[model samples]
Target: MYSKVAITGMGIISSIGKTVEENFTSLTEGKKGISTIENLETIHKDVIKVGEIKLTNTELAQLLGLSSDNNYSRTALLGAYAAKQAVQSAGINAINEYRTGLISSTSVGGMDMTERYFYDYFKNEAVQKYITAHDAGDSSHKIAEYLGLEGFVSTVSTACSSAANAIMMGARMIQAGKLDRVVVGGTDALAKFTINGFKTLMILSDTYNTPFDNHRKGLNLGEAAAFLVLESDAVVKEQNKKVLAYVSGFGNANDAYHQTASSENGDGAFLAMEKALQLAKLDISDIDYINAHGTATPNNDLSEGRALIRIFGEKVPEFSSTKAFTGHTLAAAAAIEAVYSVLALQNNVVFPNLNFQTPMEEFDLMPQTTLKHKEIRHVLSNSFGFGGNCSTVIFSKN
Candidate 1:
């Protein structure tokens, strides 16, 4: 069996807030970050709402102390900003003190710049520096460089499930003795590409997303970056690190049922949750809360709802999706949700699932709609993404 991986620290920058504390406040207070686009310029600005970070690229560059000549894309800047917080939160002055690695995920690396300079790159050499930042892995490299990490750096692009898988990989590496510590999560900046992509799917909600509601229309795209420092038990003991939570369970499975649609019975979601519970060696009853992957999309809610019913039978615990507060952050959704889950465990409160109304006709699942205070011990977070990727992570109070 692999050794248990402990989450020492977490950092996040999302549309809701720039720091973990701010995001937590927004989550608990039912304050949403979704609004008209402010930072990104696009033709579809009026039609689609987004969870933009509201910081200009130049402002972010200045925050990172980069010169005007720097070629950092918005995604790289956001990733670096959040990763730096995670490293600092972990109380590590030297990142290379042990065998450390970084596993970051992103569906849109530098598309914000690519879309802006698609035609300008040929005419202006100054903007050509951003051409190399267009790939998915490039943002991870930039974050690694910013943190001075030099081992096992990689990126995963499983659409919305990217960060959950990144966290999963980080935990597995520690379990397998491949690395003593790893910074794991995902990042993505708002872009016209994703706004249009979800528009094409007819899953871009005009109003706030209503996950698990029968009248749910679609999701609001959001931008965010979050990272969790996963360290082995030995490393935690050696460094006297404070454990935020224990990543007790994790599982990833592909639906293989469709390219972008979940199976009618939520086969992949069911398997992933089941596998996670098995790995955690806990019964379903032990779970206190579920941060569901309720994107408010019609297909996703139906599929995920069925899966929850099948897994928990009749005694499912209180569950809610924080997407209403932060919108759907695509690849970074799982990572940010993981951070929210840990916060729930730490504070002993379950954040409300805003915008929820009528229960779905297909299932009787109703999400917690108010800030419920209770002794939270273990929480389960689910994140299902496009391309049939489904992931589940269980975080326990340490």
Candidate 2:
């Protein structure tokens, strides 16, 4: 009943890899990028492990060819790099050739600099230029300008689910015939503010994260940027583009239960998945694999596990959370997982949920612990954020 939106290009720069090919190789090799923090200066660096990308801010700026005096924050630098990859991967020589837009998401836009120079801004003039890049929309604008896109650029900041909502919005805009092609995803650089904020909640894991395990501690914060180029059928047909996957279903719902935790029953998550299925016109059985938003936090896994049982009853399909491999990327979690879902559909394999040793006693749910080969048709990806914001996106092989 709805027009299918095709995903033609994807680009990602995470702790595991700098490009799509490199990320795929890391996933296939069962490599985990979680480690001690190397970039951000934080007091908890000794105890907290994170999925920090190895590139420094200067190196990232160099990669984007920005001058030393450029006001681009670390967020903008990483976003521009990944977005440029997405545009290039999509094979769009002229960005404005067709009606194209960019929808990016970020939680801590430029806080890395803001927190660093909070007091020094009064005296230091050289670093004061970064003050303008502190807003959430500035990173999106920087990414758009770098990609040569001048149309319909916006940003979403629903915390962790921001990128998933961005992808959903891009798909809807395409379905509504508002744009021929659009780039949608999220970016966030590790910042002291976020690390300290999460620490205040007592969810920062000192060791490796173990999703769905009884002894699971918590999440390791990470920083990365990922983007997917979604185009309509007309654009794909006209250009004969290579369709990587189809954005068949997407939904968003808010539980409104708590500011940071999901409802005890995962009501918002269930509604989000139900809406996605309805849009896809597919049943629960059609989902071959699920890239869960298993942040490895006690509340998220328990709530999301309950939602799984509620949705599939006794026949839940194979599901795993790739968070352990890339740590919890906050806003970019869903975007990178969406890339992993497309990869699963293309390769017919499910990535193993690393660091799982014990199953939760609350349910019989067991994550995929090994890379298993199978014929995957539809892959479901869930992303639940703070303030009970829950989102689901389904990718189907074309």
Candidate 3:
């Protein structure tokens, strides 16, 4: 039998909340955060809604107490804030005291700032500092430096599933005895780059996104970050850590079906889920809840729903998509949902998928639309990204 990776603590900043407890409260209270865009400068402001965080860049920097000259991007600021919370929650006085590492993911990277200074790069020396921050790994380095971490630090950019892949790697590393503990998650900020990109694809919804609904339009782009501390069994024993949950199983697969759309059959999603269940030594009936990758985009919801019915046949578990509460957060979607999954397990409550109305005509499946209270032991979460990257991780009550 394989050893289980313990999740000691978690942190998050989203349209829903800025901390784990706050996010939990919002989830249980059925509070929705998707609304009009406020922080971004885009022509779609009047056309689309997003789960944008209310804090400004300067405000976030102030929260982290960064110097005015610091080149911390919005992604880095959000990451450091959430990572600090995770480390503090884990009670790690000395970060390098243990064999620790940080694995962060971000598709937005510094694009938020890059887009703002795109035309002023040569004309303005003031914004040149942000030019170097315009990649996927820069924020990881900044977050590491901010946290005083000097060990293995890396960033994963698997599109929307980036954070879930980061968590999967952290768990595999702990199980392989490569490290004693690790902080893993992702961060992102909304920008015209992604806004225009998805807009060109014509998937931006005009109002609230409704996952699995028959008349679903598309997804609303959002921004946020989240991180979780995963410790090995030996470290958990040594530190007497109070585990919030266990990382029992994870699986990732690529369907290579489309550049930006999931296959009609959800081939990658199916293999990912199947492999996760097998790794967890779990059967179809064992999963108590499913945090689906239901982006509400017509292609995604239909593809994911088909995958669910294919996997469990007629017995798909209580499933819901929290994206309605926090618009599709690109790279950070899985990380925040991971926090949501843990919250569901901790409180024994399944969050309602807001905005869902009529059941889809493609299948007979329906998501849990009301707050459901049940004995949730194992929660399976799925995150699929562009380029057919699909991932799933199963979290169990400790």
Candidate 4:
């Protein structure tokens, strides 16, 4: 058996809140963060809602104490903010003292700035620095530099499941005696590119998203960042770390690399959950709460619902999707949901799946529509992305 990687600390900034405590409060209070587009100038501003952070790029950079000329994109700024908070939460003054590393993920990367300066690059040298920040890896590097970390730094860009994979990779590395501790998560900032891209796919909800509901429309694009400090058992014992949770298991699978739009038995999601249960050495019933990847889209809810029914048979545990609270945060979806999973275990509560009135006709899977307190020892979080990327990670009480 692989050693369990302990989650020493976590940090998050999303539409619901800027801190972990705030997010938890929002979840417990059933406060939905879906709102109108405030920062982004898009044509769908009046037609669609999004889980957007109200802070501006300037405000974020100032919060990080970045210089005026720093080339950090909005994605990097959001990532550094959350990562620094995670390091601080973990009580790590010397980030590199324990062979530390950072694994950050992003789908948009620096596209927020790229789209803004795509035309002005040739005429304006002032915005030219952002050209180098236009890729996914640059955001990870920026996050590491901000954290003063000098170890294995890598980036994962598996679209929506990016952060879950990052968390999985970090835990595996630590269990394999490759690193002592690692910070893993993802960040994404709203961009016209993504907003318009989803709009083109006709999945942007005009009002609140209703996950698992039959009348659900689609997902609302959102931007946020979250990070978790994962430490090996030895490091936790050596430092007497206050373990918040443990990365009990993780699994990833693809449905023949996409073409899963028809469910096909939720091939990828089913296998991913099955593998995660096998890795955790737990039965399918051990999962007390499920932070579902319910994006409120017709395809996703039906597909994921079918997958859950297939796995649990008649004993599906209490599950809810927090996406209605934070919209679909793409790359950061799994990271934020991972944080929510740990919060559920810590507080012994199941967060509500907001804006649901009716269950799907095809399945009897009705999600928990209100906050329910329970003995949540283990939580299974799912994140399925485009190109058939599907990932599941189990977080357990430490």
Prediction 3 global C-alpha lDDT: 0.93
Residue 288 CA error for candidate 2 (Å)?
0.5
Question: Which lDDT value does model 3 have at 96?
Answer: 97
Per-candidate TM equals 0.98, 0.99, 0.99, 0.98
Cα lDDT tens digits for candidate 3, 1-398: 57679999888999988988888888888898888888888888898999999999999999999888888889999999999998998888899988999999999999988888879999999989898999989999999999999999999999999999999999988888888999999999988899899999999999999999999999999999999999998888988889999999889999999999999998999999999999999999999999999999999999999999989999999999999999999999999999999989998999998988899998999999999999999999999999999999999996
- Backbone collisions counted per model: 0, 0, 0, 0
Give one digit per residue, the lDDT tens place, for model 2 in 113-156.
78877788889887787887899899999999889898999999
Off by over 4 Å in 2: none
User: Clashes in candidate 4: how many?
Assistant: 0
Residue 195's lDDT within candidate 3 is 89
Tens-digit lDDT track of model 1 for 1-398: 84458999899999889999999888888889999988877777888777888899999989888899877778889999999999998998989989999999999999988998889888998888888789988899999999988788999999999999999999999999899999999999998898888899899987888889999999999999999999998988987889999999989899899989999899999999999999999899999999999999999989999999999998989999999888899899999999999999999999998988799998788899999999999999999988899999999986
Worst 10 residues of 4 by lDDT: 256-265
TM-score of 4: 0.98
The deviation in Å at residue 254 for candidate 3 is: 0.7
| Model 1, residue pairs in steric clash | none
Question: Model 1 segments beyond 4 Å from truth?
Answer: none
lDDT agreement of model 2 with the native: 0.93
* Clashing pairs for predicted structure model 4, backbone only: none
Alpha-carbon local distance difference test for all models:
0.91, 0.93, 0.93, 0.92
Per-residue C-alpha lDDT of model 4 across residues 239-269, encoded as one tens digit per residue: 9899999999999998964543525578899
